[model samples]
Target: MHTVVIGGGVVGLSCALALAERGGDVTVCEAGTLGGGSTGRAAGGIRAQFSTPVNVDLSLASVPVWESFEERFGVDVDYRKNGYLFLAREEETAAAFEANVEMQTARGVDSRTLSPAEAREHCPQLRAEAFVAATYCPDDGVADPHSAVQGYSRAVEERGVDVRTRTPVTGLSPPESADGPWRVETPGETLSADYVVNAAGAWARRVGRLAGVELPIAPRRRQATVVEPETAMAESVPLTVDLDRGVYFRPEREGTALVGGHFADADPDVDPDDFSESPDLAWTAEAVERAADAAAYFGPETRVRNGWAGLYAVTPDHHAVVDEARPGFVVAAGFSGHGFQHAPATGECVAELCLDGAASHVDVSALSLERFESDEPGTVEQNVA
Candidate 1:
């Protein structure tokens, strides 16, 4: 069977790769260069920590792929298993932390609860006054997002999957007859496919409109900053998150740290290509000032080296929208901010939909579109910002 996967971000490339591996002639269509979306702008935090079994499982499944990509695809995505620190401020908030740890531990996530003192022991510079407890995961880490996506795209391309860049799908047409599959349009062209995967990332909702499906995925803006910190770089601090504040930091190129993660009240839905490469001074200032005051390791001595702003295909509940939205149409976008981290598992699941009509390893019904009919809670919250 021939499949046409739209969007060329990490999730799209992943689905294309998975379909090609399943012996389907796959064609990937991207409006711009591959990995040009949030995949390139993400902080690249990869971890097995989660508050849900499925999310933890997905992360656990993906970390190995990130770790072994060099061997499997002959590329290193700068996979660094530095570990993670989830910090909380008060005892009241520690309940969620405790629950998350239990779930993570149950799924073999190597999560362990830490006292305030224990948290300081791992990062001597951490301000113990800032938090009450933390859940540390040694197996969690960060990777080079762009490198990771490029590696996957190349590996799948070599496997006979057609990856076409600068090719945008303008519309989608389901077969007039129930037995037929799908038809899609690009720039001055149209094509047929047995399967159509809407891996369009932040633009997933727009894609759904083309096919007469309602995808609630919205493009929300997220910003990150690169700071040249004067403090000594920690080679092994997975990705540290100030849970109470929703801010995170990790080592970047050079003796610097990449920091950001406060949702703005003015979060806008924007075109994936409509991004600012230069750091936003206002946003950077806000993040740095708050971070410096919160952690002893942070200070005004740091310079804003650069910043990146990307779109998050946010859902009402923040979990990914992954399911067969309709017959012959699969949705695998709206990963919120965990797209790069969970691409492998999601990709394989997408293929399972094309092959067996359902995944044997994971029950992804929780991520289906119908869940939004009642606008109830999501399946997972451990990974959402």
Candidate 2:
């Protein structure tokens, strides 16, 4: 079976690897260089601290892959198992943390709710007085996003998968009948494949439209800033998230940390083609202020080293849509901001769906696009940073 995956980001590369492993002829098409899209700009957090079961399951399934990434892909991803700390300031949010921990623990996540003092013990830089409660998962950690993408790209190509960079998929022709092959048109050539996977990251909606499928995915701009702290932060400090403030920071190097989060007032929908690639100075200033409030080490004297912007392929419920949009068109997009972390398991699931007609690794049927058509869209993940 020949499979053509559109988008050479992490997810696309991962799917290609899985399909190639299954003895299918696979090709990955990228409009730009590998990981040059959102994957390169991601903070690279891998955590099972989500409030939703599906998100937690995805993280859990991907953990083993991330832990043994170097062994599996022959590349060091810089996968760190320091931990993930989610702090809640408001009483209501604190209560949610307690409830979320319960759900996470029930699913074998090894997450626990923490008192303010306990949370401070993990990261002494935190303002203990500001937060009411927190959740800590020792299994959660961060990795190098660029390394992971490159690793997957290399592994897939080694397995006889054709990886074409700077190749934009212009259009798609779905089969007249369910069994017919799909036509994938590109600038230089057109290819016919038994299956097509849309893992186009920020441009997934446009890709879906080419297949005559109206995807709910939209591109939302997210900004991140790196700063050198006035006081060197502890290397043991976990990737900390101030849930109440919508701010998160993780150690980038010895004294530098990467910080950013969602700003409610920022443009929810951004034109992926024309949006600013450079970070906004004002927004970076605000993010630095918020980081300082969460961690005392990040004081007023902290120097903003640099900043950048990336797009999140967000769905209506801020969750991923990993299912077959049509007979031969499968979607592995609309992951909001979780695509990087979830790519491993999503790739397995996408391959299973295409090759075996079912996702047996982890039941991701809940992420189907048809879920949006229901009266209730199910639970929305609260732990989004």
Give the per-residue lDDT digits (tens) of candidate 2, residues 1-385: 9999999889998899989999999989899899889999889999999988899999999999999999999999999998999998899998888889999999999999999899999898888989889999998999999999878987997899998999999989988776788999999999999999999989999999999999999899998988998878877889999988988988888778888897684466888889998899888988889888988988878999998999989887888999998888899998887899999999999999999998988889889999999998578776356
RMSD of each: 1.7, 1.1
- Tens digit of lDDT per residue, candidate 1, span 1-385? 9899998999998888888888989999988989987788888888877776777777877777887899998878888887888888878668988988887787777889998788877677788777888889888888888888879888888989988899999989898897786988998689898889999999899898998899989888788888877685566554777766767777776567888886454566666556666667887888877667556656757777778777888887778888988898999988887888999989999999988899755677778788889746655474433
Error in Å for residue 252 of model 2:
1.5
- CA-lDDT, candidates in order: 0.81, 0.90
* Lowest lDDT block of 10, candidate 1: 376-385
Full-model lDDT, candidate 1: 0.81
TM-score of each: 0.96, 0.98
Q: Give the TM-score of candidate 2.
A: 0.98
Total backbone collisions for each predicted model: 2, 0
